[model samples]
Target: MPVPDPEVRVTAVDPHVSLRTQEGARATPPRLRDVVMAYVGLTKPRIIELLLLTTVPVMFLAQRGVPPLGLVVATVVGGTLSAGSANALNCVYDADIDERMRRTRRRALPRHLVSQRAALVFGLMLGVVSTVMLGLLVNWLSAGLALAANVFYVVGYTMILKRRTTQNIVWGGAAGCFPALIGWTAVTGELAWAPVVLFLVVFFWTPPHFWALAIRYREDYAAAEVPMLPVVAGARTVARQITGYSYVMVATSLLLWPVAGTGWFYPTVAVVLGAAFLVESHLLLRRAAVSDDVVDLKPMRLFHWSNMYLSLLFVGVALDPLLTR
Candidate 1:
């Protein structure tokens, strides 16, 4: 009682603190449901579904309006799986940046809902399963393309280009283009310029499409040090860049008729849709240069419309052979 030694007291407390830390470390692991959700979130399943929508119709065209149902199923499953893999990998790679961006701050990684190692392993497993499924069930060509897309998205876009330039989405978008190609190949067991044209359409569309999101989230992107067009270039310059890409996208969509051998129906819808796209581009450009009016709602409007544009454009492709002269 006269002297409970300070050193002995301190040593006793140290063991308790260490035990507490160990228990916390063990207890902090995520629940199984959270881990499952993290896996789902990585795939960006909704986006993959939309992208795969283009695949079925392209397969129909590749097979001259009747694709094997079995092949179609294989292609869709493989494409969706591979896409989810890429998305998951991106989430894992960008976890730190995701934390800094307000829009992405609540993502699985930033929330500590999933660990990085888990995400990476899950992504790689999805890719391998998808690629193998496509190769054995669909065709080697389709599987090869899927593998290439996964590699490009993970190694090329997420790891390299996303941090390097405003054109990241422009080039990185190639990964998304493979679904059209995969669908076509799954049916025909061969590649053609038609899918390539379809690929270019999505490729060119990505810049303008993504730039709208960038405009809305400019501050977040800048804070996170992501080199999105709006962050790397001033708003005005980014606006001009978006307009230019929109023009290219519109024109590329029209080429589907000539290059992919579609009828006038595709070109006609493309014309009207293309003009609408151009109008949106002009609005984004004008607002960025001359006004700060959220009245422009142009970016948001265009962002929504771009999705419709691609959907309808693909629908037009699907309907062309049946409806056209």
Candidate 2:
């Protein structure tokens, strides 16, 4: 008889689970619900949804309508796996800071729902599987982009820049922008200006979206000693940067109309959504300027609106091709 992999087997009682609580401690058998959710938590599934939103719409625009079913399925699955791997690795790496931050204190690692070693191995497995799936089912270009995104998120953002820079999310957010490029390349098997422009839109949008959250959790980041912009800088400074990035983000979205020769839907959505984004960003800035009211900045108002803006913009991206065709 073949021997099972020792690392993946906990005890003879359960051959499937190797998860342990801590060093030298006996791991009580995890409840079914807890075990399921713990692994699901590793993927950060909500973030994968946000990442996929940018992906599918671009595939529609790239193909000028719905792409092949096989292609769409392959790309989406590959992207999800790749992103999950990156997020899981981030959770493992940031376990310490995560324990200190209010928003992250309940995460799996901080709560000891899973061992750090298990999380590390899970992340590596997903990363490897995702790369192979994309390479085999889609094309190597899409596969390569997916692999690059995972590496950038794990190494560039989580391991390196996250703790060291106030500009962490600004640059590190590039990892999230790869979905657009991946979506485009998945169909056409080549890079082009349209996807590159859409990639920039997401890249610019990330800072403001993230900074609003940073502003809301400035205290948490400070407590954890992570130098997010709002944690290290004055509220006014952070708000100004958010406003600046919002301008570029909106402008980049508008450029997509011209660059892709997209129809009225995209341009109209761009104008309307861009205006709302500016108003909210300016409102946050005004709130920040009130010295006593900085604590009540309510940056989440803009944060939530930014989410809507991206969703609507991408919806228009998908619709433009169908309507124009």
Candidate 3:
């Protein structure tokens, strides 16, 4: 049985007096709290934090472990705001699919915490403000790269590739990789191979990191028709891909020493840490071989550790110059 729609009733208390009433009238109107949470969801603070973590280290390495304080701060702030804006725009584009996924159902647009129009407006405003701040406070090169990254993520990746193919993250990873180059350019006012190496590191690292996550939430992705690597390629394929990329990441980390000119601490740490990363990747590969497997929690653990790995690895770069000297 279906529930009835609200019924309107009118009654006359007296010959000339009339009263009208409606059921289900405004049960708890929208509140300021909901609006604020929507803004937070728009920003994607966790993603911004991770992106800026990659950004700031490039600044330090660009200036040889000593970037100008103002430039560093500006780069981080502008990068964070710009990345946040890009994420919000992505939310706007993916709202329909997000509503279908349990993981994303509570998001601002999906939950009606914020309207699509409001999100678009806020995203664009943040982007413009961030671009201006970066140009005025940082450098034109950094600003340009930041703008490009935002455009790539919102338009090229989120709007198009995401729905079209599983390689979305492979190409889209380029957007996040830009922060490393942007950070380097912020301090040096030019490009070089060092940041490029860092960019490659993150670019290759992205697939495994995201695939691991997608593996954990496979059903959600399947339900949403997201076309993630795990959905298109299958778990076994994704695991092998993770292992292969882990090897590439390790090999690339070793090259940073000569290319980026870091101290002994880096290679020593790189060899040890890189080996551990490989071990984790192999574990994921082994676990993914089973048929009808739902999710690999262990690989998810590795995915989390992989994030910590990159952060600590970059920190090694900053500390190497001091520790070795």
Candidate 4:
């Protein structure tokens, strides 16, 4: 049987009342801690961390050194809330497919720990508060970018593109690039060639990064009828597309050196990181080319490595400004 709904959603439940069953029998109330954890999970904190990783380094570089502590704090808080809003809204929208997929079945909406109504309210509140905070405390430019990202993620990606095409993540991923732009604008109060290149880097990087994971969980997407690339294409085709995007991603990273006029530190790190990323992509491609079955793909190897590559590349980006001084 499905878990019975509480009189109030998990996030708003009264402390003293136990959750009741559908049959009207008394059930033990979930601890406040569990309810809190469920709410946090709705925001997809791990993804927010990755998004913010790209965010701060760009701010550091834009400042040409350290940014103001107050501005940084305000931007980080606003960015966190904005990202949380986008992610929470995604959960609310995708709750149907999420329940069908093994990976996302435990999310708050699917488990009924958070009602759709509560989730929608939480996301909207965060988005409004984040935009207002950034506009007043940081800058209107950053606030605008944050609001735009929320709209793209909620309306453009989650609502329209996601279920309609195998290329869902490709264009939808554009929304994720806003943080780099927002970070740059927060400091300079305008756009520039440097942040534009960073935006492109993320845009190209997203497909390979996400597609590798999609390859690993192809069946989950298939079962959910989400039509992710790996679900619709053969292993070789998916791997080839991943390799193509990986090439563009690395080439784009190299362009940042010449265009941004960064020091040897960033170029050197990019070369080493790009080489490792390419090597993994090639290995996955070779496996897919030789194997008749998707089982031989080992796409997760590249998926895990992609995470490390982005982390390392951005770490280099963060250090370049300070070291070049």
Q: Candidate 1 on 47-145: residue-level lDDT in tens?
A: 786778778889877876767778888788888888888888888898877766656655677666677998889888998999899999998988998
- Per-residue lDDT tens digits for candidate 4, residues 31-108, read 788778888887787788788888899998898799898998999899999988888888888888776666666577
Error of 4 at 137 (Å): 1.2
lDDT of 3 by residue, 41-87 (tens): 77877777777788877777767667778888888888888887888
Q: How many clashing pairs in candidate 4? A: 0
For 10-67, candidate 2 gives per-residue lDDT tens digits of 1222212222322235357668898779988888887888889999999999999989
* Cα RMSD, each candidate: 12.0, 8.1, 10.8, 6.9
- Cα displacement (angstroms), candidate 1, residue 159, comes to 0.7
| Models ranked on TM-score | 4, 2, 3, 1
Model 1 misplacement above 4 A: 1-32, 292-298
Backbone collision tally, model 3: 0
TM-score of each: 0.87, 0.91, 0.89, 0.91
Deviation (Å) of 268 in candidate 3: 1.9
Q: Going through the candidates in order, what is the number of backbone clashes in each? A: 0, 0, 0, 0
Compared with the true structure, model 1 gives a TM-score of 0.87
Q: What does the lDDT read for residue 8 in candidate 4? A: 12
lDDT-based ranking: 2, 4, 3, 1
